[model samples]
Target chain A: MIAEKLVQTYKVSFDQNNQELALAGSMRPQRAAEMADCVKLLETSLASIRGTFYVNVKRLVRLNNVAFHSLAGALLKAAEERPDIKITIITSSVIGWSTKKFGTLTAKNPKIVVEEYDSEFYPGQAFLEEGGFVPVLRTQTKLTWKHERAILPRHGLEPGMTMADICCGIGDFAVLVAKEFSPSRIVALDHSKSSLAYARQVASEFDIGGIEYIYGDAAEMLLEDGQFDFVSCRHALQIFNKPEMIVNELVRICKPGGRVYVTNEKISQCLGEPRGPSIEWTYEQLSKLFADFDMDLEFGPKSYQALQRAGLEDLRIESFMVTNRDGDAQAFADMIMAWEEMFAGGMSEKRGDDAAFVEKFRRGFEDHIAAALHPGGYAGWPVWVASGRKPR
Target chain B: MDLGAGQTEAGEFTLLLEFDMDMAGFTSNWSYCDRLSTYFARMISHNRSDSLLYSNLFSSALNELLETVYRLHAPTGSFVCSVSRNGAKDRIALTIPVDTETEGFYRDAVVVLNGGDVSPRYHNALFSDGPLQPNIGLLELAVDYAACFSIEPADGNAIRLIAELTLEASAP
Candidate 1:
């Protein structure tokens, strides 16, 4: 059986690594049998439709890692036994090699392959390997932490204050607010289930209380009227298809004397020139949309007269530049390499030889990351962190 | 259950039961209430079961008391009630009325109701001998009587009753 073959190979190659000669020299019949047994166990377990089993094993030969093969084979066996059980195999480094060497096990049952990846390439693949949860991105982590630090002073967050966080991706900021402010209740709303799952996991791991994770589109979530002392969003307003509807929802949930904080990164400039036309067009549309809701937008020094025109009281705007200088140069190189891979993928798909475009993007991204880390890059790609407060 | 009228400076005031009496009867009749009391006593004597039912019944009673306050207080114009569940206890604290006359009435009623099963806790101090000075301590007594009236059935009827009560109280 394929399951037996997988276990035999797994036992034999358990300690095998990248060295081809060592792997060739270590191959033995007895070791193969042990690997087969391991595969059999996995296959048998998967064949049963009851419980869920997860195994983490590393140090398999690059091409024929038995753990990956056994998991794949077991998934196939499980599907054959009962097609309803959901099986997810998340590999970080060797998935591509396994798929290529073993042939696609998910071909017969496409749904069984929830996702497959090589973690070394997909930085986000770290999430799947770590039980399908990833720590918030470092930049996002810092942003959230800074927002937490600014909450009490900027928004007057205090214990027993009811608060709502809209577009709360993974609820990192929401968890911080729940823990630090000890709000009477903190409703963390997100549109993505994956994000909400991570948020729930973080809340559970930290034993943070008084936070309710709500899943749905933020604009459509039926929030209780006048229930929150403050409604907040972090760096999510721009991506909202209907920014105006979201703004209105924020205001609707806020109490009569409550405040609404909209935190967003404004891309006003690109590549040391005025931002691309597309970016400006998007913002203009956004400005017009918000105007319909009587919101006064305060963009950097070129503050819109519409803010005053909309009769917004206490309108304020601030800008800050974030740079990643403390990290090693290799990190910058790795980032550049990742972007190169992305460009390569797109270029390859189009069958176009755009090596010059690839080089330009690589150089730009590398310089940007490096400069931002260096004092010289501080002014480049400056992020506008602006917030406005709604009147009581 | 009848809640007796009490003398207040404003005038005579009466306590009204807000839940559907007919629904309460359908769930727990008077005879079944006696049976529950007997079974509970026996169960306690034998140590055969945990007192989860007692705890659940107490929680249900408290929820009902708060729900009544949330509904009637606003309508009567005495005080406002905002029912929030994320707090430590299932209870309602009436925001103190600014008017001295109204505050006096509310405080006296709460003081009288202190230490009862549904004891009233005053948000503000009460004036002695005020027009609203009917002992709210009686409110707690009323809850106890209502708790005793709750009956248990052979099936999962008690759980269903609690669910129904919770739904009624939490309905916006």
Candidate 2:
């Protein structure tokens, strides 16, 4: 009878894509017969199964109102029968229709939950320029021991050595490195006092000691010259208004024979974007802003040029391709959110709420990443760690 | 068996599936495509009389060719599958839009089809020597499925791969 119903209406069948059950094909006419038939098929298939079921309807292009109801009913019935089963339906946040429809459908069923993901959904609150640091526009930090182990060894930080982390926005990298590298004292400075307070709280929570969190201008720190055995800045160089002045401070604070490491990621180099309406324009504005700061756009392996220009020796520059296996799209989405905040007038003037801007760039990122990682996708970005020793 | 004057047309018929190639992702999960081709072959072969041994071999051959295509390409472009009929013969074509470099590489392959092997010689100003690595998928179709296939350049950085399968008429 269900097969007969499918014959009368549109064809729908289930296929397995890894852990998820993918239901593909079109559903039209919005008739109850077709809806009932689909429900019956789902019930039969799910009655014997237990535990969580991840059903993805992304491939199903069209579904009538009644079909949504039928799907909801079938999912609810399955959940009620098992009592332990959890049903999660992943959908696009941009589609208002699906949001409302799925919302209404899952309203009564406690077991059924609809999860919406959009690359542009900035999780953190957007804060306008405060000490040249904005928390809302920040991407997830690479602060793990793996990233630390990559850059810290070159510095040869002894246990009693002092280090300075200038422009330490949230102090994540500095804290992680301080704990792992066993430095005697590490002073982390940032322009944003609020960010410094938060970073201090995080450091205290981690019980990391022998560190001081200071709120000050990096380019004009009062610290004595050659006081720090090692000086490093991670990822926040491009945001500085005068990177050259700050680099001078980084060099000034470092002792002779001590190491100065300036590492940054070239976002554009790693995250390829497919040409879309707003992609070129958004990046163009960001580039202009970066130019104003004298920040090198190509800041990875080529970063040594800046340090070399500052008169550092034994310069070693290594560029790595850091693949985003777990959260590639989300990280890129956050990057767009940051750009949107940084250029609010330019971005919002074109599209209010940054949804359109986010969607265009986010989709471009997804598509580019998909194509790059296709046939099988290892999504990644380029990270350059350039370290040079001060003249001995 | 009464074979009436069959209809022969030149124009195209219906299009089947259109898929985008994600080469990196597919390199690891290639079995999915293999399974898909076999499933599609079974679906298309339904309700057809398989009195001749070649019919079963033909379906298997088509599945093999589809799987081979899945393994070779990076799957970054659009893959279009369309079908057209000429009298008793049905031709299924899979067209993929590829970059110029890839198209050049494809042009130099040594292909074996219909139990006969042929190496297509190409004369290019850039590289006087012809390319290598035969289009093995096409060769399998010709050998096992008794199908005639060809790989030729299409519009705007794309190549067309077409295979013709002739079906025997049933008893009247």
Candidate 3:
């Protein structure tokens, strides 16, 4: 069965002050076909907005032939509905596929225009995973003894060594490695420029040196081979689009005999699992849901095997548990909410009805929190800490 | 409607607040940013029902603008934020200037916002420029929370952002 349109797949807004109506997201056929509905919804929300309506297709990675027609037709309807409105479609140079249609779509209506923009990274993969984590949350996790042991000496990190922290969200691990091991050189690389800047700020507070920050994709880093003595990425493997490729890339950049550490959650180990209502969902569930629907999730647990496949020796996996006491029910709720918010978009494919599914998950998660708050109750989950050595 | 900072008139359809600061003041102090967001959130929650849409929009718009400012903050640039209402519409405007070196980065962001390209691809590409951070504020300010918004370039090296909320039924 064809899935329903993904909720929040695209967002439309009309800024009256600026006289602009903006649309952003991948214009899939389902969403594009509902253009009139979108127009109706916006009009219902705020009828006063009328002027330049811009649809930025730079991030709209793929538009089916039908989607192009649907979107163009919708905008024409919008323009006709309100003769005062001009429709503009902004596209990226990388999206050569949709530009020609946009040009033809708007050629007849002077009210519509196509603008092309050049961006270093548009319509690209997520560079900053987990939405650039909170510094406090990151530091709290890092300050743990077990985390330190897994990442530090156990991973063979030491002074005078060169290292790379791949997908280094906010570079907290890089800052820690730089501070504790005093590496000769450390490269903090992530797709998020803001996280890197924060990482730089954190690193600056310490007397660290030889730390360079690079903003680029993990799958395709511009670093030289054998450049670092060790490489590490934490809490980001499962969410990566291509875990094996990233693992191979990590292996490629590490000096022979250097160590590589990758950490991620085994969905089955997350707190509130096995106890919450059957409605409780994990990110892994979303992936499976999409798979069942014949769609690609491109996210899941892939650390240990990928490392071994990269030919790293002495591969090992250590599991650590994070638990919350009855007193920490609120904290538990926050955690569940964060996870739901992050992965909800993926669940859209499997949603029977957007609101009901969302409400079910939300209410069920809340009930689980209430259960956790019961006398002597506790919630915990396991984290897979894995490492291997690059062959010389 | 006298839409000035800190102006509150009883029985009026709207209230207005304005703020102006430099990059150093806005980014150098986290408390300041937090206070600004909290104020916007509190004002709407206090003055109206807990369901006021503009309240959340203001919070999201301010946070988004602040994140961008941190990424492209100039040593001596300015930051301007305004929250006003014209009849049934509540509006917010944020403007910040970037350092010359980072102007290209800020410009690209403006392009994405103006184009209404908020896909992960566009955002990831825009943010890939390590220097980008997560816009949790903007994420929280999803389209469900606001009527409309836009991003564009302003005078000099600054970027101007605006978010609007229409309160026809909810107007007092």
- DockQ leader: 3
Interface RMSD of 2: 29.9
What's the TM-score of each model vs. the native? Answer: 0.41, 0.40, 0.44
Ranking by TM-score: 3, 1, 2
Model 3 DockQ, alpha carbons vs. true complex: 0.02
State candidate 2's DockQ.
0.01
lDDT of 2 by residue, A1-392 (tens): 01222221245554433234555443432234656666776776565456666666543433433355457656766777787777777653222224434554365576777775432222221233343444442354642235557556765655667888887777776777776677776777765545666776776787776566654456656444697888988765655545677788899999998988877766556443333333444444445445544444555555688788889999888776655444355454454445544544433343343567555544544454453445444445567888888998
Stronger candidate by lDDT (2 vs 3): 3
Best by TM-score: 3
lDDT (tens digit, per residue) of candidate 1 on A51-81: 3333322122222122233344555666677
Listed models, DockQ each: 0.01, 0.01, 0.02
TM-score values for chain B across all models: 0.25, 0.58, 0.62
Error of 2 at B7 (Å): 99
Q: Residues A257-333, candidate 3: write the lDDT tens digits.
A: 99898777655444453355443454345455445544333322456677888899988776666555523455655
Question: Which scores greater on DockQ, model 2 or model 3?
Answer: 3
Looking at model 1, give its docking quality level.
Answer: incorrect
Q: Which RMSD values do the candidates have, in order?
A: 25.3, 26.8, 19.9
Q: B69-152, model 2: which lDDT tens digit per residue? A: 554453465555544555456666656656665565445432434335432211011112222123534543453235776787
**What lDDT tens digits, residue by residue, belong to model 3 across residues B1-172?**
1124566652343447767777676777543443465365435532331122233334434545455455556677678877677755666667777666666655554454445535444223222322224342343233323346566677877867666665333211
Off by over 4 Å in 1: A1-138, A268-312, A325-355, A373-381, A385-392, B1-172
